[model samples]
Target: MAEYITEQKRTLKKILEDNCDRAYTVDELFCKMQALYPSKAPGKSTVYRLITHLVNEGAVKRFIKDGERKAAYQIVMGEHCDCHLHLKCTDCGKLIHLNDKISDELLSTVQSTSDFSVNEEATVLFGTCGSCKKHSER
Candidate 1:
């Protein structure tokens, strides 16, 4: 039998899906959840637990940005959980998924040359995005 999903979990999943381009810390997600459904908002602990469960179930991805105190979570849809590396914008905190054949070639090269394997599922590269770079240039 399939496991049951509570209303809180469903709401959290929806929020994550709606904001697929970015990640959110537990506190941030909690605040947004509360804002979206004031009367039905779950507690912070509940949101955290649900997110943890989703991560375990391979339904979400968790990452920690440089100098960040808390980890952020993003929803994993379709092949995104396996077929891509994540690029995080340091300025705007946007997370972009890069699914290019070049990434696979780089992974292969690393493994062949250095005897080290890249964990693509959890790998994140931090840099300024194109929009951020343009904004800074102006």
Candidate 2:
């Protein structure tokens, strides 16, 4: 049983890491896991448990999607993720890690001009990604 649970956790981690650019709701994750391994897919509760574990470990970021109450999860890109703001594609749900230099400049500018401090870890700019913008232009 422990081995099966560990396997399921590994599978879930792979799914999240492989698609680092996208965020997934719990239901979506559950469905994807089911689709990938019909026989070995973890149950909904198990998926939730694994997600909780990942979030606690700082390997995942959890946030509520815009205009929705349910939360979404995405894989943390690297050790630097906490130091930079993120960009999310509204059209495709892709998450882009902002370059460090640019992020620092932006944050510095905001701090120098306004009294409000931005939380890099929780902040995400939403817009159409380059690929989605190109597709729409066609």
Candidate 3:
């Protein structure tokens, strides 16, 4: 049973890492895991448990998406996630990690003008993504 749990944890981590382009709710992740391992996917409770662990370890970020009551989780892309703001696509649920250079400049400007420090980890700019905008135009 211990070995099985370990394997489940590994599989869940891989799924999040590979799909780092977007955040997923618990139900979404469970369905994805079920699709990948129909016979052996862990239960939804187990998925939540493992996700909590990942969040505690800083390997994943969990946030309440805009205009939603449920929380969503996404894998942290790089080592410096705390140093930059994130952009979340409202249409497709994609999460974009802003480049460090751009993030730094923005942060600097905001600080200089407003004298307020933004919590990068908790800050997410929500908008329609490029793909969604293009598709909508068609």
lDDT of 1 by residue, 10-67 (tens): 8899898877777899999999999999998888998898999899998887877444
Query: lDDT score of model 1?
Result: 0.80
Deviation in Å, model 3, residue 15 alpha carbon: 1.1
Error of 2 at 117 (Å): 24
TM-score sort, best first: 2, 3, 1
TM for every model, in the order presented, reads 0.57, 0.60, 0.59
RMSD of each predicted structure: 6.8, 6.8, 6.3
Reference-based lDDT, each prediction = 0.80, 0.83, 0.83
lDDT for each residue of candidate 2 in 1-138, tens digit (9 for 90 to 100)? 498888888888889888876778899999999999999988899999999888898788887664467888989775467878889887656578887789989999999999668888889999987877887788
> Model 3 reaches what TM-score against the true structure?
0.59
Off by over 4 Å in 2: 78-95, 98-138
Query: How high a TM-score does candidate 1 get?
Result: 0.57
